[model samples]
Target: LNLVDLRLTGTIPPALGKLSQLRRLALHINALSGTLPPELSGLSQLEYINIYDNKISGTIPSELGALSQLKELGLDHNALSGSVPKELNKLNKLQLSACELGGT
Candidate 1:
């Protein structure tokens, strides 16, 4: 589901992980807060996840590395903290942003 640029509010529901067939999820440019749901790692078929330009905080889940099919992960301009998970390096095709987790 592509929910980008919707100016959405609130946090991402962990229940979304139930979408086992999901290929792309874009929640960028919204007012959503809270950490990325580690449950999202359940999306084995996910190819892209764009949640940039939001108010979300917390660290990127290392479980996301389970997405062998993931190609891009955009988490820029958020309040996220911590270093990028080395497990993410396993994504050979991943195009990540703001994973450095410097001062927020």
Candidate 2:
């Protein structure tokens, strides 16, 4: 499926984590807010995930690093607070914004 430019609210459903064949997930510019479900890590085939400009608040889940194939992760301008997931260091392609992380 070709899904883009979707404005979804509430926590990201754990069900979405089941898309084993998903390649890209873009849900930017929305009111979606909550901790990222570790279940999302199941999407091993994901290459991109755009959930920027939202109300989502919580520590960046270390599980995100499981997207070994991920090329881009957009999570800027949100209420999220916490140390940047150290696991993220494993990603070869990451473009996180300042607002999502900072020195304590």
Best by lDDT: 1
lDDT of 2 by residue, 7-35 (tens): 76788888999998999888887778887
TM-score of every model?
Answer: 0.88, 0.84
Cα deviation at 65, candidate 1, in Å, is 0.6
Residue-level lDDT tens digits of model 1 in 1-104:
98888889999999999999999998988899988999999998999888888998988898998888897887888888887887787654543354447432
Deviation of model 2 at 53, angstroms: 0.7
The whole-model C-alpha lDDT of candidate 2 against the native structure comes to 0.78
Tell me how far candidate 2 lies from the true structure as C-alpha RMSD in angstroms.
2.2
- Regions of candidate 2 where Cα sits further than 4 Å from its true position: 1-6, 98-100
C-alpha displacement of 66 in model 2, angstroms? Answer: 1.6
How well does candidate 1 score on lDDT at residue 34? 88
Estimate candidate 1's alpha-carbon lDDT, on a 0 to 1 scale: 0.84
